[model samples]
Target: MDVVVLIGRILFALLFLGSGFGHLTQTDAMAAYTASKGVPAAKAGVLVSGVMLIVGGLSVLLGVWADLGSLILLVFVLPAAFLMHAFWKESDAQAKQGEMVHFNKDVALGGAALMLFAFFAHNSDLGLTITGPLFHLG
Candidate 1:
């Protein structure tokens, strides 16, 4: 079960890790797309979000301040779901479907982040973490 938990954590972190890398490495291309999506200061947004994802993903991956990491991710994903992938704003059917997928994906990720935060904040057993639940209630 512990191994399974580690595996799940690794898998979940991979997406953000890779995407964050892309955001940094492919800044111009990513920022252009973000601009097209009407994100103001897209380049700055991309850079900040990229750093946020990297920090959050690494924290979660290592179980270092994981509760805080989970919160960081939740913060990133929730508004991004609407600002970046507004399915309702799409006019074309296929575009709407694609946007819906992205939107739902963000929402789902947000929910998962919240769950991880709950587990970490509660000091639940999360296997294979170097150090965990660095954020704690008094």
Candidate 2:
């Protein structure tokens, strides 16, 4: 069970970790794309989000302060889902479909992060325990 948990954590964190690396490495491209989406302070947003994703992903993967990591993910994901993947605002069928898919994916990931936060908040033994003082609920 513990091994399964660790594996799951690694798999789950991979997306954010990879994305963070991309955001940092491809700052100009990412910022330009974000700016096209009308996101203000695109460059800064990319950098901040990149750092958040890296920290959050690492925390969860390492089984240390996962609750806080989950919170960080939730913060980054919710706004990102709405701002970046606004499917409702798209008119073209193909573009709308793609945006919808991305939106759904972000929403699903956000839900997973929320669930992780709840689980860790309860101090459940099903997987990793929250070791960070800030995230400790008890």
Candidate 3:
């Protein structure tokens, strides 16, 4: 793999890795935030999302089953964009702008996940994988 790809993967994985750790360690705070967004069983949601983020982040970072990992990330990100960052529902200008930024960031992350999924979908000539591609659509 190119050094750039490795670096990008590390950088991308760090975002989720840190957030996932935070979710588990600060469950109370994260659950409160999720509950504020009207998520039912907010604590459960936080815990589930936390595990998902950690698993996916590790998979991508390690380039093992990256296709599946990217799909997991895509699944997590798309819904989160709508469910948590519904900027259109915000009335206050500041809140709306804040939500919009988060929403856009999630959307962009989703897109990146898709790109990674495609890159890993075709064959197992992966530059960095040990036992990979594992499962893909192509």
Candidate 4:
């Protein structure tokens, strides 16, 4: 792999790993935030977020089954970004705009991570296999 790509992978993995660890360590805050968003059973939010962070972050780091991990993150982030952040009209005037922007940026990052999984799908070494060939340059 090119040095740049390697660096990119490491950087991306680190971001997710750091975020995951943060989520694990700050479960109480996350749960409160989830409740503020009206998520059902806010107490469960901590466990859910922690698992997503740990599993998804690890997959990205190991470069194995990362696509699935990215997909999982995609599912989680899109809803949280939209519903919780209320990037639409639900935001309050005082700080709603800032929150919306932040959530939107997170959504973009999640998308980039998903795309990275596609770009590096060929590097699986953790017994996670795709069913078909990934390229068609011929």
- Candidate 1 at residue 92, lDDT? 100
CA lDDT of each prediction against the hidden true structure: 0.90, 0.88, 0.89, 0.66
RMSD per model, one decimal: 1.4, 1.9, 1.2, 4.5
Candidates 2 and 3: which is better by lDDT?
Answer: 3
Q: Write the per-residue lDDT of candidate 1 for residues 1-138, one digit (tens) a residue.
A: 888877888898999999899999999999999999999999999999999899999988888888898899889999899999999999999999999999999999999999999888886566788786876664
Ranking by TM-score: 3, 1, 2, 4
Q: List the residue pairs that clash in candidate 1.
A: none
On lDDT, the leading prediction is 1
The 10-residue segment of model 2 with minimum total lDDT is 126-135
| lDDT tens digits, residue span 51-137, model 2 | 999999988888787888888998999899999999999999999999999999999999999988877766656455446424545
Backbone clash numbers for all candidates listed:
0, 0, 0, 0
TM-score of each: 0.94, 0.92, 0.95, 0.75
Where model 2 places Cα greater than 4 Å from the true spot, the runs are 124-133, 136-138
Clashing pairs in 2: none
**Global Cα lDDT for candidate 3:** 0.89
Better of 1 and 4 by lDDT: 1
Q: Please report how far candidate 4 places residue 55 from its true position, in Å.
A: 1.4
Q: Give the better candidate number (1 or 2) by lDDT.
A: 1
lDDT: the better of candidates 3 and 4: 3
Which ranges in model 1 have alpha carbons more than 4 Å from their true place? none
CA deviation > 4 Å runs, candidate 4: 89-91, 122-138
Candidate 3 stretches with Cα past 4 Å from truth are: none
